[model samples]
Target: MTALAGLLVLVSLAALLWQRQHTLLTYFQQEEYDNTRFFTAWQNVRLFDLRATATIVVALVVIAAGAPFVGVKLALAAALAGIMLIERRYRFKKPLAMTERAKRLLYLSFALTLVLALLTVVHPLWAIVALQLAPVTLVLANMALKPLQTRVNEGYTDQAKAKLARLDPVRIGITGSFGKTTVKHMLAEILEASGSVFYSPGSINTVLGHTRHIRQRLQWSHKYFIAEMGAYGIGSIKRLCDFIHPTYGIVTAIGDAHTERFGSIEAIAQAKSELAEEACLAGGTVVVNIDVMQYEPFQRLKKIYDLRMITVGAEGSDVVVDAQETDGASWRISLHSKLGLIPDVTYDLPLLGAHNVTNSALAVTLSLVIDPEIADQIPYFTKTIAQVPHRLQVLDTPGSALILDDAYNSNEQGFMSAVASMDKLAKKRGGRRILVTPGIAELGLEHDRVHARLGEFCSDRCDTVYVINPSRIPSFAETIDADKVTVVEVPSFAAARAAIAKDLKQKDVVLYENDLPDLLEEKRLL
Candidate 1:
């Protein structure tokens, strides 16, 4: 009976580990396989969850009813709890894909779990303790595999570099706190009018991700390769620049998008300037938004790399944005070249938010800089620019409600711009303005200040606001004028959708400002 109870405890422990591995891997992937971040996120959440606690109680009650011995009862209960956990479904906003890297991490994590389960033979309490320490096992596994992961990354990066050298396409690097992905999409489309352009699709901008794309998709016939460079730390963009060696770099406006990771605006600025610095050192022409030029590090880098610098979107800039006006349907922007290389032009753009106007202008300015001859085709291409998906994208609903899907927006500036657009369109159509948001992420110390400002702005523009994970940004609801506006606090986006279904009326405008991943939206326990 003692031996049988020990065996049952091992079975339950194995089941629990299997279930926990899935969730750990999902967040691990979301954190870009960074063990430090994964561990930090793990620590912030509780160690025990409601389901696990309930399952244990129910299992113990049932086992105690059938088993006479205390040891047998505990063992039977653990076996039953394991059975319950094995069939558990973990919900994630971004489901875990069993990619090659994910598979490797999963395998290594399970192997570590198996070793911990081996201790269950000596005492059943080891299994219970291992349940709480599961997150630590994953962190340890990731840390142990770092050397091997580095080697694998190096191999792929080397292959990508070789392929890039042989093809020798015009490489253009785009980097900023926000709008870099949108600009990459816009430039890729505009440049495609003239030649075969190969831009990194979506936000796949990391070293390994870009390497995979280059290895798999890059062709000899491709004339241009647009690289959207994203940074996790100060040297992150520099690492990518070292890999691609961009001939043209565009620095969009720097902001507090990832200020938490980098710690300060100056660090973010210094990190972004790495692209400009690298591109300039390579004798590459760089187009920078005038806002980025304010940073001291950027100014110093610009002074060093001033030979091939072109400023845009401000007075005395090489590519000047004179005016930006939007009707309810689209935007018409007037821009002129101060350097007189490219012709002055007015862009009729079909996109939302004033930031997009700036994004489009930056894309146009860089496109012309690459080839002044394509200036004639620029206006038509600008007119035909399709709205980037999920970045303030407008969708028509079956009812009179207009859906503005800005689910990918994360910066305060972008959020405010979206709110402004929602207000304008709602008033133009004589409709109620609605907003759904999880607020912004990685704001660090500026989180409260930013959300308070957004709340005040939304109080005027929005009639109905659905604040998801309201506890994450309590200041948002606190600042809103509850008398005039209706603020609904819901746990998940699905809950908000259910509420909206009941109250949505004709001629209503809904803006999903920013959607967070499951890691930020919910508190998960081991």
Candidate 2:
């Protein structure tokens, strides 16, 4: 019985750890292993999660009451097994590649579990109680492994830096709360005409991600390298800047995209401004979004780095977007620079949303600054700029449903812009506009207010709104009128897709807004 209990505890703990490894590591990485945030996320149990609570309580009680050792162990093992089974059934599993740091942490966690299990020889109660410390064990392991992980990361980063120094391409770093990827792709398209351009692919914006891209994909022949820099806290972008040493930079727009992790808008701006500051320090020109110039940080940046700064926006800026009008799945934009008013440049962009015009304007300004010879090619490149995979990409469906896919890293501003774009498309196609969303998540303290405002916005814009998650329904209910908008509640994405297919017809436009991964509670079927 003692050996059997030990085996059960070991197997159950292994299974649980395997399941939670990715989420645990992600939080650890994002929060920088801050105990406060780690513990908060660790213990963020759902209110009225009676099943989990009851299981924990009963296991403790049994161990405390000196129940048969095997029985108590069996109970704990059964509880863990139940949890693992439920997670496997309901959770969407993505292919998570464990980093060297993650692997070290995992090994440490397993060793801790084994050490605790060995205490079963003295008291089986020790093994039973060890299950409760799963989260704590991972935290302890991370704390232990951090120094070694840092050394390994630094070693690889140094090699990447050496490679970068040898090649010395014209590096342009782009950072902001949003639109960095779009701007990166836009700049890449324009600059390709000037020379061979290598931009960081997709959302590979972190320090390690950038290092890997540089070491593996960066080529000697590439004349321009655009690095998309992202940050979660202060100095994060500065760290990236220290490595790549960009010759030019663009601060797209300052917003509340990651304001939750940043704690405040000021902190977010400070973090994002690191890119421009570093670029200016390196004697490189920095392009500032004129709209965000109203912010104090950008104002401060301008005061200190005025010579290296160029502003772009709708009006009253160095690079001006005189007009932007959409004509059935394409955008017509007119741009002017300090040099002079360039002819009105119109392009059939695969992208949607007026916000993209701002991104495009920044890209165009930077391209002209880099190579004035590409001035005439601006219209051609803008017309041929391919659609970014998920950001406002249009999908071809076998059915007549026109699907506008904007289901990645959603923010309040982006969501509103998508809604406006959807409204326009529906009007042109003479179809009913439908919005299918689980609503946005990860706004932290601003979650309720943001969703409430989103609901209010959807009430007026969408003909039919299908809300997937029930947790968001209350916030939406606060502002949305059920009678005014045909609101349907769904338990899963499958169900939502089914409903759309049943009602979809030719010219029907369905805008899939912010999609949450299954790891988030908002994606769960209630």
Candidate 3:
């Protein structure tokens, strides 16, 4: 039985992962790699991979060591069912068109399992021992071979996605530093308001993640597919546009989002503008944000292309939004239409800062071109658009501390905006602002300078500062006097949480700013 279990495990592994290096690598290198999500889904299915395989292996091994017949047979049948069920899970994750390979593999693995079934039929007691040992041994083998998965993944590139975009019927590429997600969500919402829309959810911008998403889940009903292209590298956005082949496009704004990865803002801008260029070559309309400072300054894009031009923001834009802010509480949302004001009324919004308003405005501008009705519907999306999770999400703690969980990985603009918001709120709530931040990262050498500025900015807003990463604290200390800034340095989030956990009082506002990734080379572990 243990031997049978081991064999079943091997068959399942082969069926699911092995002998299909081509398919895996091809999907891995695509621009919109949705395989990361698939990988996550696969991890969920791996439970069965272990249970079925291990149970049969243990049964066989135990039988080899001499176990009961009844136990081994039951385990063998259960293992078989587990294998089938896990494959079913894969089908659920992937679309019918792309799941052919997985389906075929599953069939082959199930056929191999028949050998174990025959073995169990011969001698049940021996089968049980065989199954037991099979699971234990195979589990160790899978663990040992895990590194091969990483190597398999690394071989995938973004070039293939570009190849597909050349064949894409209609591609609408979108890229920017800050508001790609907002524009993606807005475009999806507007398009979905009328016709079938195919857009990836959230920020699945890697090669493997996007390709699998495009291949596995992209529905046939998709007429106008909106893709939000994001980047941390030079050619990432261009590669994605090559895959998407968007006929219509938008670039919201370029800022210091991933300048650390690309080295400079200009490099970042060029990467972002690649979307417009790709759309132009595809004979698609490129919606240029005239309001975005960086893209406008680049200059050359304003001259190139025959007909790929749609101006948005500030100047000669057909669809325009006029915003008038009133005392930091709400902004009047009005759209310029030939028929006149579309929802030309000011409504109170509970959002934190001007960035949210700008994001909504960009949505309105971009949505108007391809989708006019939903362009008018932007005000509604604005009202309904949930504040992005963990970005300025203010909560009331038990002690009534106004806990502002702005822990979503922040940039200079975001951090500054958060500080400004807290300052406004501080004035409104009549309480001193307390900030617990680890400061900004991924700015390369600008880390120290950004930290210094943040420290200076915080000195004006925060009554107390709970610093998380102490190595950057000296840069901050240089910006502000130590006496004015009460800096409590904790080595870890856990420790910071522990120390600051006791500092909350009624009406004390705390901002948790800038959570860093765990993989920093000069990492400080508390």
Candidate 4:
């Protein structure tokens, strides 16, 4: 029995570690901020702390039922209760959206573990492995159930469908690795002048997200619907396209966003372009960024299929935004037509980076068909965009210091834009710029190397740098003065807050670039 207890303890420790990773994974789902916030593994354990307490009761009941050292089991239950109390007292994070479900599942799993532990007295080896995997399996089971549960709420979506049906709206489906979210936002903004529509929150690309948006917020009067569909491999976007059956498809630039699963950029492009294929079958227009080399085949796909491909680029674009560095004008904003006629219209777009010009251009042209009045809203859209709530939001604080919160830049181009945004602010303010980031992750070797170059870019311009995670050691090496850059080891969020509070002083331009989100939520590399 003592030997079994010892083995159980080891298995529990491993389970604790595994749960931490799982917890971090949950927080990472909404990881849109950099140094301002972070997801810690400890929070995972804490959120599921209730399971630990319930497990003791369950264990006690089972052991008592089995008549195996009743007093010891009772004492063990009491000890477990006390330990859980202490654990709850020490835990330091807010309850996440998945907390309630996790608690229920954890309790059930611990009960199972107790049953298995009893079996371990006879079958030791299998029990140990079972104990470690119980909580994980519970989580997986819960995950499997959520989609089914969400689908049952199909009546709400039917109302949305009815409303959209009344409006006779032309729906557009946008999908890609990096720019899909931005593109969706852009499309909504550009199309608002034509008729009423919703942007569907930040990265509302999932099936549930779309379903909820359509079910709840969709109005009968709206003329257009823009849905951003995201996928990991083949058939994923096809599933989404099948659901909405978009009239127009927008394929943003594709890269090695999910190379680990997709195998290569080619595979990623192939997976993403399915939306275009479906849109063509639906007799809908397919708008693609021809500037993207992967879109070269899309240009060809335009000729063969029903796909009406609208291409945008810096040199020759239907709608373009040319830039001049008044203080910081990195992204050019212009308007044109396919016939190569400049519309002599301009927008002071709040969004930075030259790449957004293409994004905005593509959005503007595609939207005009559904929204001819969009031309009037361009200037208003530019002002209201407000940096997409952490994507290059520049704030001028007291004491002559400026803070550009580009917390959502976890992609290759996004990282570059952050560097440029920081430099722009630095040049304007004439103060030292400070970059605080964990750098981007899961971008495969190409993106990792790209981040290293970003480190070099920061080194050239910024005066001080702070990296939240030690995983960016290669980035630190690329720095101008490796010693000058501070590397903070982050195991949890509290430690990160303390470190940032200590380093941040007045009179400095700070750019919190990106924080890598854990997988299971996105096909985007991070």
Candidate 1 displacement at residue 308 in angstroms: 1.9
TM-score rank order:
1, 2, 4, 3
For TM-score, the strongest prediction is 1
TM-score of 4: 0.76
In model 1, state the lDDT of residue 436.
95
What is the C-alpha lDDT profile of model 1 across 1-526, one tens digit per residue?
7666656656666776777787778887888877778777776555343455455455556655885555654655565565556536657788889987777778888878778778866754455556666777777878888898899989989999999999999999999999999999999988987799997788988888899999999999899999999999989999999899997999988999888888999999999999998888888888889888889987887687664777887777767786556676677887787558467777788887888888988888888878877878887898888888999999986766899999999999999999999999999889899999999999998899989999998898899899998989999989999997999999988899999989887798999988898778878644
The pairs that clash in candidate 4 are 318-336, 320-334, 321-332, 321-333, 321-334
Q: Candidate 3: count the clashes.
A: 53
Off by over 4 Å in 3: 1-170, 221-224, 291-297, 305-321, 326-329, 335-350, 396-399, 481-483, 521-526
TM-scores of the candidates in the order shown: 0.94, 0.87, 0.63, 0.76
Which runs in model 4 stand beyond 4 Å of their true positions?
Answer: 1-79, 86-95, 98-111, 117-131, 139-168, 305-307, 317-321, 329-332, 338-344, 472-496, 518-526
lDDT by residue (243-332, candidate 4, tens digit) is: 787988787788666675577777777788788778877776777776553454565576667226666665554434455544474444
* Per-residue accuracy of model 2 over 393-442 as CA lDDT, tens digit each: 88866657789888884788889999888988888888999988877766
Best model number under lDDT: 1
Tell me how candidate 2 scores on lDDT: 0.76
> How high is the lDDT of residue 344 in model 3?
34
